[model samples]
Target: EGAVFIPASLAYLIGTNIFGPLAYKMGRSFSSGVVNAWNELSIPLAKKFEHLLAPNAGWGFAIGMVDSAMMPIMGHLVDLRHVSVYGSVYAIADVAFCLGFAIGSPAISGSIIQAIGFKWLMWVTAIVNMLYSPLMILLRNPSKKEEKEVSFNINIKILLTQSKIKE
Candidate 1:
């Protein structure tokens, strides 16, 4: 455990320092997706070796890297929204994070491990993460101008519909 723990923590610090700045250069969505996908894909690959120091260390590093990148990307996503909705955005994010990470992941992973074992768990997780990665990479955060235009169009449509009803 110590072998894994020490390397993971050290790599986490390195990944945090590296990816935080890279997010600005590469765009948050793309950076986060690639990092996350790599992290997930690395697991099964590393697990294939089983009980080796090097592969496990690398797997731990990948885990640390993804975990480090996620928080900042989440914050960047919230920042894309309106200041008025900041509280709501953060509240929703916190709830999802808590539900998914704090509660759901552990419970689900534990069941998977019990049903099969660690080896299969890694593969299952990798498959799921790969399926989710495209969406994360492709999702666009609309610009402020686009948001205003959309809002205006909706308002106009509502007004027009109301006028037709009154007629």
Candidate 2:
């Protein structure tokens, strides 16, 4: 069970290296969409070749690629829109991420697994993942609204006043 995620971790490292530059060239949303498309496609292929290690590895790789690429896009968007309160934005995002992945996903997946079993769940999730790619590709970066620029200028003067401390 734990061993299965090794391929995903490796793929994440590789995807980070590859997509960092690609994001700069192609735009973050588009790059993310491409990686997600890879992820969406990998599941069916893995289902088809369920007996092979390679297809499962590919599925892991694709998942890693999507995660690696999509994770930063949220931060980028937050920075663009909420530069003043980016810290708060990040905190909220972190909580949401933890809740979704750690709690919601497992709970939902357990129910889904019980209801339909694992094989159909993969297919269903793959279709859902496929649906998101088009939205990512079509996403237009929002134009940053002009805000009153805050200037950082500090003038500090320390004056030591000698006072009688001892009487």
Candidate 3:
């Protein structure tokens, strides 16, 4: 319990202190991509070193990090995409998560893990999570507004030069 608590506490603190602001600057889509990318890269090594870290605490701590980080970042995405209705969107999402937690059980997860095999289950989860990284492409980059201003200025300059040449 101590091991799980310590790691989980650390993860939450770091997520709140470090990742939260980073996410705000990077935008929800990019931050989520970075998080997933880092996880996909780190997970295999972490599994190999599982015993060294703590035998049974891995699942608890990892789940804690996921729970801490995923929810708010997703809320941020809803904020970006639907500025006016983000509150409603987040409320529905929160309710859905609560229902999932209420209905989901260790036995169900255990059965699925057994059927899929733990490694396979992990790999499949990684792949599915990785699928989200590409979804960042669909998101309008947060910097696009600044980029548009710069590009617009450049375009005007080019048009002026072209007109002068035509004269």
Best by TM-score: 2
Show model 3 residue runs off by greater than 4 Å: 1-5, 29-86, 100-107, 140-167
Where does model 1 exceed 4 Å of error?
A: 27-81, 140-167
* Winner on TM-score (1 vs 3): 1
Every model's TM-score: 0.61, 0.63, 0.53
Off by over 4 Å in 2: 27-52, 70-72, 138-140, 146-167
Candidate no. 3 TM-score: 0.53
Model 2 lDDT tens row, 1-167: 55655665676677667766566456554544444445545544553333334444555555545555554666667766766556666677678867989886778889988999766776666666667766765435665645544221111111222223332
> Per-residue lDDT tens digits of candidate 1, residues 1-167?
45555655666667666756665555544444444445555555554334344544554545555555556555655666545445666677668867987777788878878999877776666666667756655434544434777889999999999999999
Model 3 over residues 47-95: C-alpha lDDT tens digits? 3444323422333334444455556756656655544456776677788
| TM-score of candidate 1 against the unseen true structure | 0.61
Instruction: Give the 10-residue window scoring lowest on summed lDDT in candidate 1.
Output: 47-56
Q: If candidate 3 were superposed on the true structure by all CA atoms, what would the RMSD be?
A: 9.1
